[model samples]
Target: MALPENYDYFTREQWRNFHGKNQLNTVTGDELAQIAALNDRISLTDVQEIYVPLRHLIHVYLRRYHQLVEDKADFRGETVAPTPFLIGISGSVAVGKSTTARLLQLLLSRSLPNQKVQLITTDGFLYPNAELNRRGIMARKGFPESYDMEHLLTFLDQVKSYQPGIKVPRYSHQVYDVLPDSYDVIDRPDILIVEGINVLQLPTNQQIYVSDYFDFSIYVDAKAALVEEWYLQRFGVLLDTALQDPLNYYYPYAIGDRQAAFTMARQVWQDVNLKNLREYILPTRNRADLILHKTEHHVIDKIGLRKY
Candidate 1:
């Protein structure tokens, strides 16, 4: 399928060739497995060919961002605080966004020797289970409205303004709930990767969007059918691991009939995750500065770069 008109589309080989003469650092097989999400496929060659070039692009963007800040300071003849470059990664739940965000964070941090790059997933911004129950959005957990949009916007605004001691709530996948008052502090960073399924969603009723603070954004793309397969595969893995613990939210599925568990996974994917992707996530693909289109086996076969 053709990409949107505004994009300069390139096949995988073509995109790989765009990496300049510099021999960029590559992730080893062990490291790839460490950062890779369960059920997704990514090799060192993929890192060298795809993520290295992407790191170079982000490096250029970071440099230009600092330069622009300096230019503005000079124009005003006043000192201004250095700004942290925020990058947003958005995609469907099972599309490997966590892996992508972690890859970019690692690559960017290593490539830039003098700066600190931090990665955060906005799952932290989700409302607590009790709140969701009260609001009657438990079934719509990953939907845009299910998130604490107001708090998310405030967090981003503070980050953009270079605020310190900013604490973000953490969500526990094992329990399938937000850990109340448990927080991750984001100190001032040179670059921050803010990733989530709804990161690139359009502006909501609020005057500001979570993406308004983003200087650059990425959308991971793949067929919904393939993503559903991945979602099921991941659920199975969790049953083997996370569900083994009685405290886990999925323990019921783990001890229940295996076929029934599979059935439930499919139902949740169709009713919740897939619905959110179709109504909210996929529509934001074109808004991304870059799109990574994945094919079978989670291989990124094409890249689409926006011309403007």
Candidate 2:
């Protein structure tokens, strides 16, 4: 594939050389197991080559960001503390974005020992299933309109302004809904990673976009067909786990004919996920500061760094 304008694209071999060796020693095998998403694979070598370089770049951004913060404070003639540096990670469903987000969070936390780092998903900002059903858009759950963008924007505003103890609604994959009365408290952190498919989306209804608060952003890229395969593979794993749990949202499908269950999964990938990716998510790809392009089996083959 041809590279986009304003981006310096590099093959994995070339990108790996940007960061020196021996960085993989920090991430252990057990940590890799914890960070990897279901049906997603990531090795320590990937960390040393791809993520380590990525982390190094983030540090470069952070240093510049801190200098600007001090410069702005000096212009106002008042000493001001630094606000949270927000990183937004976005991509299509089943594209291993969650894995990337979690991995980056861990890496940043370890490297920036003095700075506090926190990670949250925009899934928490999604409208409850009941609300979606009432709105007659339950079938289009992952669509841009299904999110409570106003609420999300408000939360991001608070975080960027250094608000403490802000609560984020909790979302449950097992129930496939936003859990009522459950929340995660985000104390003001030095750095925040917001990950979701809609992170980089521009909702027409909102005056400002979610990406407006981001100091840096990354978009995970992969072919639609490859994503579909990974989606189905993940669905199968979900079914296997749901088989023993009656409360699982997938329990009904897990108990039914396996072939029919897979058929439904494929249909969802085509009618919902694929449609959202093509129309909304992919269109925002060029807006990212960085892009990680993946090949077969979730291997990142190339990296794109925006020049401007």
Candidate 3:
């Protein structure tokens, strides 16, 4: 299917060529592995050819954003309030959104030596497992209804207000729960990246969509069937690696019947993740400032930037 209206579509080669021979991947193999998500492999060549241009484009946006804010402040005859440039990234479960977020965080931080860039995931804003159970939506974890939207909105509002020491809730992967009284403080970052499956979602409880805070946004795109395959592959890797810890949430699956484990994983994908992707996530793709379309092997094959 063709992309939504008002997009400037570019083949991967064409997009990479825009930067010409000046490109150089500054990150190392170790750094790539550090930022990469499970089952997502990105090479230094990909960084040099793909992400360098994208990073430069973001720099351009940031510059223009600062000027716009200054102009507004001058018009109002008020002191320019220091505000953050927020970027929202959204995508399916296994479409490699985390890796993209981490990669951008690292690249942006390195390039903008004077800027303090922070990356935050919306998983921390999810209702804790106990709350989910009480609400009878534990099975629907990761759905729009599963989040503490008010708390998230408050945090974002404070961040935009340049509120110093704004505390954000922290989620734990090993425990599979939101840690009680845990927070990651945000203190006046020049740029903030909010990446999540539902960052672009319009929640029923709020008048302001989360994307309303975003100066720029990205939607990672790929075929649903490919995402399912990627999700399963990631599950297997987690079983082999992360589940080795006795306290790991998926440890039971790692030690249980392998076929049954795979069955349960497949069931979760078909029932929860895929359903959320189609109903909540895919519909918001056209709202993104840029869409990165991935093909097999997790390679970004095309880029679609909104003209508006």
- In the range 1-308, model 1's lDDT, one tens digit per residue, is 24677999898898888754265665667887999998888988888888888888877787888889999999999897879999999999989999999988888777776888888898998889999999998889989888888888888888888899899998899889889779899998889999999888754687766677888899999989999989999999989885559999888889889999899889999899988888998888888999999999999999999988
For model 2 the local lDDT of residue 238 reads 100
User: lDDT tens string, model 3, 155-206?
Assistant: 8888899999988889987788999999988898999999999899887767
Task: For candidate 3, list the clashing residue pairs, or say none.
Answer: none
Question: 1 or 3, which is superior by lDDT?
Answer: 3
Query: Could you tell me every candidate's TM-score relative to the true structure?
Result: 0.97, 0.98, 0.97
Best by lDDT: 2
Global lDDT of each candidate = 0.87, 0.92, 0.90
Query: Which parts of model 2 are misplaced by more than 4 Å?
Result: 1-3, 20-24
- By TM-score: ranked, best first: 2, 3, 1
Q: Residues 1-308, candidate 2: write the lDDT tens digits.
A: 24468799999999998864545547888999999999998998899999998998999999999999999999999897859999999999999999999999999998988999999999998999999999999999989999999899989999988999999999999999999999998899999999999988887677687888999999999999999999999999999999999999999999999999999999999999999999999988888999999999999999999999
